[model samples]
Target chain A: MIMIILFVFLCHAVTFCQIEFVKVPMQKKRPIHLALYQIKLPLPGVVSILHRASGLLLFLTLPLLLLMLENSLHSAQTYASLVALFKHPLARLSMLGLLWALLLHLCAGLRYLAIDMHLLNNLKQARESSKAVLMASFLLMLLIGVRLW
Target chain B: MVSRVVVGAHYGLRDWLIQRVTAGVMALGCLSLAIYLALHPGLDYQGWRALFSGDAVRTFALLFMLCLYYHAWIGVRDIAMDYIKPVWLRLLIHVFVILTLIVYAIWSVQILWGY
Candidate 1:
């Protein structure tokens, strides 16, 4: 937990430092700074970024998920065994991560669907809607965690 | 420009339709299971074994698994396509998901048949 937080903070620090540099004449031309922070990236933008991040995490975590599902369905004995394994500390932690991933994926996927349907298009509404989706995802994940343990 | 937009919307509409249809099937299966379990709250291991031994229940269970797995696969694929950007990585992920789904389907069949 602390390690994850520190890693995130370290990442932000590195990114900030890289972006806050004094321009030095280099032998080669530097890539153009394309970050939109200078223009005040809004709440909707943050939600969009997180949507993509969560999706990528889900993609990377697919193998473990498939194995879990497969093992559960292998037989009655395997199913019972696997469910019992879920009582372990690491399993509980992973389940917590899964709950968060599921909530985020649902929230962001619903937002994408709304956008596809041409709803929530206005700037203010987009920001407000994204904020609402993010809050819902957080609350849903919290509920899942409480229910699990 | 117009053609490209039309093609995009076409695929979007198809995806939307498939997703909704699959969701409906999954909902029905889940509701049936929930109601059945609620009605038979005291079912023991042998009782469940006997119940699942019937053709109707076995077929229902198989179809339920298939629909559920397919729906989840579609959802996962859409999520991946939305996020993963690198061409090679995305392709690899997609292939891996497909393989996993295939393996899961086979496992589901085996479980349903008590193998």
Candidate 2:
């Protein structure tokens, strides 16, 4: 009720002053176009996603890794059996994938540590760091691959 | 309606701090393990057991496991909160993850000390 009275007095004052009014449409709700495939990720953005992906992969497989540790610790026989399991082609492939994941996660995590320390302040430095991380991880994985083979 | 305005503000700084702290702890643990491995090559089951049998390394490794789970909780929680739109679903996942990490901690203890 008080708001209604104030509006009436404001209307009278506006009329006395002969102020012109302009109309505008409501644009509070705007359309958003967010197509995932249409978007291009920057180098650092790609590295960020890969970091999360690798972490998630490692996380989901934690149980299996823990089981391997358990077996290795159980006894010599069990430890030999676990070592034998690693020789299978499927096992080796998955091991490679996991190694790569660990490498990527580790490198990206170190990069994040540097970022938290205010080292990668500029866009160029961030991008370069991301590139360096990817290269280092990939090269490390390849080195592990050669040793594994 | 009940207000849900303050959920995001309070936990942000704490979780950020935890994630970095846990990362640093785990990094140190891994670095020490790597250095040890570099010094002692061709580790068999006995050799590996000897490494973990030490009190200091074993304690640090256990600490690393705890940090890993806590760090993982924060990361996975953020992922679920981002990608899982349904509140109930995210809550369910959060609960499951908490339970699983608890189990993993127990498993780590068993692996390190249990026969």
Candidate 3:
């Protein structure tokens, strides 16, 4: 009888262990489609994304700008050549683009700074500020563009 | 008041502050440059060279370039952290970025002060 009881206990322990070791598959939900044109992001969100994009654009173009500055400062000949290059319509257009990017990035950066300081804490204030930023950037761009062209 | 315990790299505050400070410096530089350019419209080679010939302006320009390098580094590093998931690949990309930024820094110094 004791031997039979021991055998039953062993069987029970083995079955329990087997059950504990069984793997369960996790059920994951499908990801939502993130179509850019189909979805309308908030004004602040759009501004924020543009801020990042402008920053990246500025960073990528830094080397070229630096080279230009260096060449312009190097000597009279190089500086004259660069000035002549800038006289081209295409060069002026590109410069206008860079100018706009710089202005937009600066405005957005100031907005971020204000937000960080808790000056624009509320959603309404944030939205208004973002709109102001956009308007300011465009106005400044236009002013600079006139001179540039 | 209950104190909160935070873990992980905890680089957020420092990076944020640095970015803002560097941005401020760059803004000042840009303002000065803009004013000079506006004042001297149709600037020729001699005029342009004269603008950067000042010791004070050269120093400011150098400082601006250094700040720009740091600012770009932090910005790019944050982007890498957010988007790059694979550990080894992310690390490799980071190393590459650091190297490139270093080279740019050195080149900038040469360009600015080499003459």
Q: Which candidate is the best by TM-score?
A: 2
Error of 1 at A116 (Å): 4.0
Model 2 error, position A64 (Å): 0.2
Q: lDDT, candidate 2, residue B1?
A: 81
User: What is the per-residue lDDT of model 3 for residues A1-149, given as tens digits with 9 covering 90 to 100?
Assistant: 99999999999999987765553322234457799899888899989888878888888897789889888878877877887998899998888888888899999999999988889988899899999999999899999898767
Ranking by TM-score: 2, 3, 1
DockQ, candidate no. 3? 0.48
Off by over 4 Å in 3: A1-38, B1-10
Error of 1 at A119 (Å): 4.1
| TM-score of every model versus the real structure | 0.57, 0.83, 0.80
Candidate 1 chain A weakest ten by summed lDDT? A19-28
Q: Write the per-residue lDDT of candidate 3 for residues B27-107, one digit (tens) a residue.
A: 999898889889888887777667667878778888998898888888777776777777677777778777878888888
Candidate 1, superposed: residue stretches over 4 Å from native: A1-41, A59-63, A69-80, A117-119, B1-12, B19-97
lDDT of 3: 0.83
iRMS (Å) per candidate: 4.8, 0.8, 1.3
lDDT of candidate 2 over A1-149, digit per residue (tens): 99999999998988866543322222434557699899899999999999999999989999999999899888999999999998899999999999999889999999998998899999999989999999999998998687557
B1-115 per-residue lDDT for model 1 (tens digits): 4433111123557766776666566557655765776688666545666776788887987776676566566666766566776767767776877787787778666766753
Model 3 Cα shift for residue B60 (angstroms):
0.8
Query: Which candidate has the highest DockQ of all?
Result: 2
What are the candidates' individual DockQ scores? 0.12, 0.73, 0.48
